[model samples]
Target: MSRISVLVVDDSATMRSLIAATLRRDTDIEVVGFANDPLEARDAIKRLNPDVVTLDVEMPNMDGLTFLEKIMRLRPTPVVMVSTLTQAGAEVTLAALEIGAVDCVGKPGAGVTAAEAFGDLAMKVKAAARARVRPLGSAPVVEKREGYSGGDKIVAIGSSTGGVEALLTVISAFPENCPPTVITQHMPATFTKSFAQRLDRASAAHVTEAVEGAPLETGRVYLAPGGHTHLEITSGAHPRCRLVPADPVNGHRPSVDVMFNSAAKHGPRVVAALLTGMGRDGAQGLLALKEKGARTIGQDEASCVVYGMPRAAFELGAVEKQLPLGRIGPAILDLCSAAAPGRDQ
Candidate 1:
């Protein structure tokens, strides 16, 4: 019931003022302190102990990424990155997310108003305040397994808030010949391409931003391109990606619900999982897939950053099984195996 206290960290006075003013607009959020750089930010963090921190991706003296790493290693506080909406900025923001930031929002660029840039900053800060921040450490090492024959089954995953690190953990464990997979991670239009590239670099399976008419082939992972369109799967002997330009579902253009509903048409041939997120976007869609006999999984709460999407789906009886973050990747692969049980079996 208490207000969410926030520390604003940025080298730019303009940005600090803008961020502080924007957050103060929300009745539930209070800007507790400001820091011109990471050194000042460090002292502010120790003194104010704000529930959340809004961090700029690039700052003077100490870069945000290094400071974020130090914070996660030493203190493990919830953070939301404020970044520029450029390709390079996207890469850095993704890095910050992987380093344990709960979420991110872009800075106002040329022709973009401050309001447009930070419209959702307060909401994200609220979510960050509730996030489960993990200390920096070695990721769980998933032992590679053999005997995978994915067949015609397609895999769909949905995530939000802390998805960058979660998705990296999940997808990096995938084998070279993993099943066709599609992901709808909540992100900005400028970020998905870089994220896909990041995923491709980390995982054995090839990952890319989804394009209309692309075949959903084995060993390929399609990430829904954020911003203008929703990624859907078309059913046929050979399934393919479909990008639909429609109104945002669940307040998101690349809504997980749209993707899951589309994949649901494949029935038992589809396998879906909802990972750590901050809303109910994918709950009903996962339930629809379950009703159509698809195998469904949810990331258990202990491993979730926000525990929103998976919790919603689990409550709706959409998840046939729930597993930890480290286990979800292999579990999905197991479900997609050719020898796995189907609707008739």
Candidate 2:
């Protein structure tokens, strides 16, 4: 395989050098060029045509968000945003992701060691290089669905990699009164909390980060917390969310497998969907759901950024249906409504 060529774009010379050197630490990644600003980056992009771009969220002449929007609108290449470890920077970085940035890394602070920060940046860059990003004009569009109901139905959704944009589409398609939904998206604690907030702002349905002992209610989507805690379901007269401390399963503490397996065992009628992500984290758990007679769905390859988890599930005979990102929401709603008759929320 050819090396992943990268272009580092930042106004600060130190940042540019630091990012370039960090990427160079991997023999598989090559620092093709460095750009001090968007103008310089534009020229480098035209000249070098690198595989990935490491973009600083704050830049001179034009901001990173604006440049990112332009890239999504025109070029459609994967972009990894470099942002400060601040509240405002977090907000801006999330905005960039919505505008088509593949992923983000917090810039090392005065107190943070560069080695540690760049270690993460290198991984994100490699992931970005493998991601399939759609241009802004041609991206999937999911409209808000109506007539969705909660009929003793529970939904479990899992994703990573391309999940931010994918979940935005899937959750926005839900009605104001939808089934009780649980989600596991691989992310950091800071990013997961911010993501829940962002999704709450964008979606008609209530979306919040899952808290231990929270009741599973209609019209709300609970996101598993990003930490050493795993989210599970406790079946009874009233299903509720449970947060448990456990070793990372499949290398994720809040692993998709943990959530799926829990829901399948406890949920009365489970509607499970695995979205785009890398690796085999959710495959066996999704299969477990299928064995328990739960309705299973997977995002199809053409719409996936990585297609690893979904593909693994599909090949394992776990997916009852494989749909595009835009269609998965409606299909999930359909399954929930059909699972139990004579109930609507």
Candidate 3:
């Protein structure tokens, strides 16, 4: 097979060189070109036609966001954002994801080293290379869920890889009074806080990073904090968010399986969905939910950037329904209506 070609775009010479070296460590990836600014990137993109582009979120002459817009508009391709590990940089990086960049890794900054910077870059670039690119204007419109009833059910969603884009579409469609939702997305500490904030801004429902003992409430969403803790549900008058410190499960802290397995103890009151991700982290836990008569859904392969997780769940007979990415939000809403508090028939 041919090598996975990459174009490294960053204003800092050191950053570009460092990124190139990191990607080169993987035998399958080759550095096709380097661009110091968007203008150079524009020219190099046409010349090199690389499989992936590692783009700096900030640069002189046409910022990365505007340049990313043009890339999505004129030429849709897999792009990964290399953003600074700052609040402003986090905002820009989240916008990049919304604009169709496959994924992002924080640039080396205070509290982040070059070694930590490359932690996910090469793997993300490889995944992005095989990712499907959709034109900027051709995305599915998010239709907010209407006529929602009060639901007693708890919703747990697990995703990675194509998740930032997929979750934007799904969560934004939820009503302001949607069921209590818990999400466990594979992300590093630098990204999750910004991601949760982005979700809060985008969705009508209240969204927050999970705290140690936050009470689960309807109309609110809790995103698991990235790093060392897993999000779990504790039984009570109403389910509450239980953040527990633990080793990585299925190679991820705050793993979907831990959340789902804990929710499984609640029996039929939980509704679980496994979104697009790189591996089989959530499959078994989703099956556990299904076994307890909870409604389980999986994103279909065609709509997934990496079909690994959802495919694993489907093969395991964990998913009661397999729907395209565009349909999952409405499907979840339907499930909520069926099981709403006092409305369950």
Candidate 4:
């Protein structure tokens, strides 16, 4: 296969160099050019037509977000955002993802080594190179859905890579009093809090980062925190969130498999959906849920940015229905509605 060519764009010379050098360590990636600002980056893009671009969240002349919006509107090229690990940076990075960036990596912080920060940069670059990027216009106004009764069922969702945008769409369509929902979106440790805040603003359901012993209640959505804890559910009359400090499962803390498997033990009154991501972390766990008679849904390939996790689940016979991104949210709600006829339990 041809090497994945990349253009490094950052305002700081040190960041550009560090990013280029780190990507060079991977034989599969080639740093085609560097740019100190969006102007130079635009020139480089026209000149090199690199397979992918690594963009900084902040830049001079024009801000990265404005430039990114322009690129998605015109060129529609896959981009991976490089950002700092902070609340401010997280908000900007999430905006970039919604603007069509494929993934993100954080710059080294105080006491954090460059090696640790850039460890996953090359992998993300490769994923971006293969990502299906399309022009993203203004987000469609999702008219809030109604008539959703908080039945006995609960909802579980897992996503990564393109999940920020996907989750925004899904959650926005939810009614004010939706089912008790649990989500595991693979992200850096510091980013989940900001993302939860973003979700809460967009969603009628109360969204929060999972804390220990939070009961699964109607009108609430618990997002698994991103750090060293895995979010699990304790099965019983009152299911509650449990944060486990165990080692990473499937190379991810707060693994989707851990969450899905835990939900499976809660019996058949579960509704689960796996969205776009770049690994098989949730496939087996979705299969376990299917075996226990839980309703399962997967985002179809045409609607996925990477189509990795959802594809794995579909192939494993875990997905009872595969639908486009616009439809999965309503489908999950329909399955969990009190008016829906009885299924195996």
Candidate 5:
């Protein structure tokens, strides 16, 4: 296979050099060029046409988000954002994913060693190179459906790259009486709490980080805590969340597959959604869910940030419906309602 060429974009000379050096260490990745700002990056993109770009969230003159918007609108390519691991940075990085970034890696702190950060940077770059790209004009939107029965129905959602925004969009459309929802979104330990809090503030549903023995209740949303795998519905009468310390699955500690697999075993008749992400993590688990009689949905390629996970599941016959991001929420409601006995036909 040809080497995966990359363009590094950052304002800091030290950061640029560090990123380039780290990428160079990987035989499969080649640093084709470096740009200190979006203007320079644009010129480099036109000239070098690297397979991927590692972009900084902040830069002089033009912000990375603005530049990223243009990149998606004009020449869509795989982009991996390098952002600080702060609340503000997390918010912006989430936005970048919604705008079409394949993935993101937080830059190490000031006191941290370069070797550690470089290792992570190299991995993200390689992942970005393999990510599937989509046109910005044709991205998926989350659609809202009315007239959902508020009973014992359950909803399980999994996502990675662009999950924060995509999840917010889908869940926000849910009414206060929407079904009990459990979510596993790829995020760091420090960020999951804040993310759940943010979601709760934005939506009508009560959102909280999942805890062991916590009952899955209606009108509530549970998010897998960071740094731990969250298994679903261990007990039937009062479905509770289980947290376990395990090795990362598909390179994520709180993997979507782990959650979805558990859901398949415990809540086979529930509704499952596989959203935008960068790898084939949830594919097998979604297949398990489908085999066990769960209604499964995958975010369509056009609306995905990377289209890796969903595409993998869809190809494996794991997904029952491939819908745009906008139509997913309503579709879930429709599926659940159809399964109900006395609901409006």
Candidate 6:
């Protein structure tokens, strides 16, 4: 079989060498070239035509975001961002994903082992190589106008890997009257608090870490605390977050399936979305939601960081509409407002 070719782009020679070395360890991946900046990367792209590109967020000539925007506009290919593990870095990484990068990996500084910095980089690169590329013009941008006027409703979403950015994009698009949104994005316990806080700042909805017994309210968003499986509503009259200590489901602690299943039981006929992520975490639960008559949408393969979960759901006939990442939020609003019996909005 042909190996997956890669291009490493970073202003720092050390980082570029480190990333290239780590990726080359994987027999299936071949580091075809390296570039010091976006301008240099452009020439490499025309010459080598690599299957994927590992880009640094901060660069000299042009920042990764600007390069990503240009790449999406001129020639959309799979790109994975390498960023530091700071709050500022997290915010920029999220923006990069929204702009067009397939996924992101945190960079480890000196004294950190390659094993540490490249924790999941190889896997992400492999996934990106297989991903479908779409032009930036075809990608969805957040809308400034109100798209829905609906009564109290709930929106349950779940994702992993590239979800940090995907969730932000979807939630930020929501208006003040947007339905109560609950999310279970796969992340470490140490990061969930910061992630929620960051999302709260960027999004209109009141975002907070899910606490046991907290009432589910419209216009507020809840994130399932990491390190535990957060199940959906237990009762119809009052739906609250349920966190449980259990073995990881579908290889994720805060599994999407667990949340979706809970949502299907508690918020029957509500709107649900399964965004980009690895593995089949959300597929079965989404199928259950579909069976319960909830409007379900899956991120199209072309827009996913890793298409595993969404593809599984799509193959199982669970998704009602397969949409690009940009259209997901609007589609949810439309579904909530449409006249349907048993649906709150």
Cand. 3 TM to true fold: 0.94
lDDT of each: 0.91, 0.86, 0.88, 0.90, 0.81, 0.81
- Residue pairs in candidate 1 whose N, alpha carbon or C atoms collide under 3 angstroms: none
Comparison by lDDT, 2 against 6, better one:
2
Shift in Å, residue 258, candidate 5:
1.9
- Candidate 4's C-alpha runs over 4 A off are 138-145, 342-345
Whose TM-score is higher: candidate 5's or candidate 6's?
A: 5
TM-score of 4: 0.97
Which portions of model 5 miss their true places by more than 4 Å?
110-115, 118-120, 130-139, 229-231, 338-345
Measured by TM-score, how close is model 6 to the native structure? 0.81
- Give the alpha carbon lDDT tens digit for every residue of 92-187 in model 5: 887787688877777879775678655567766776776666667565555667667765667899998777767877887777877788998887
Candidate 6: tens digits of C-alpha lDDT, residues 204-282? 7789999887788877888988765655565576677777778888877888898888888754547899998877889
* Native-referenced Cα lDDT, model 1: 0.91
Span of ten consecutive residues with least summed lDDT in model 6: 336-345
Q: Mind giving the per-residue lDDT tens digits that candidate 4 earns over 1-345? A: 899999999999999899999999999999999999999999999999999999998888999999999899989899999999999999999989988999999998898899999998998888888788978784533444457776888999999988998899899878778989999999998899999999999888899999999999999999999999999999898999999999999988889999999999965789999999998989999999999988999988988889999999999999998988888777878888888745321
For model 2, the stretches where C-alpha displacement exceeds 4 angstroms are 110-112, 143-146, 338-345
Give the local distance difference test score of model 3. Answer: 0.88
**TM-score of candidate 2 relative to the true fold:** 0.92
Error of 5 at 138 (Å): 5.2
Pick the lDDT winner: 1
TM-score rank order: 1, 4, 3, 2, 5, 6
Cα lDDT of candidate 5 equals 0.81
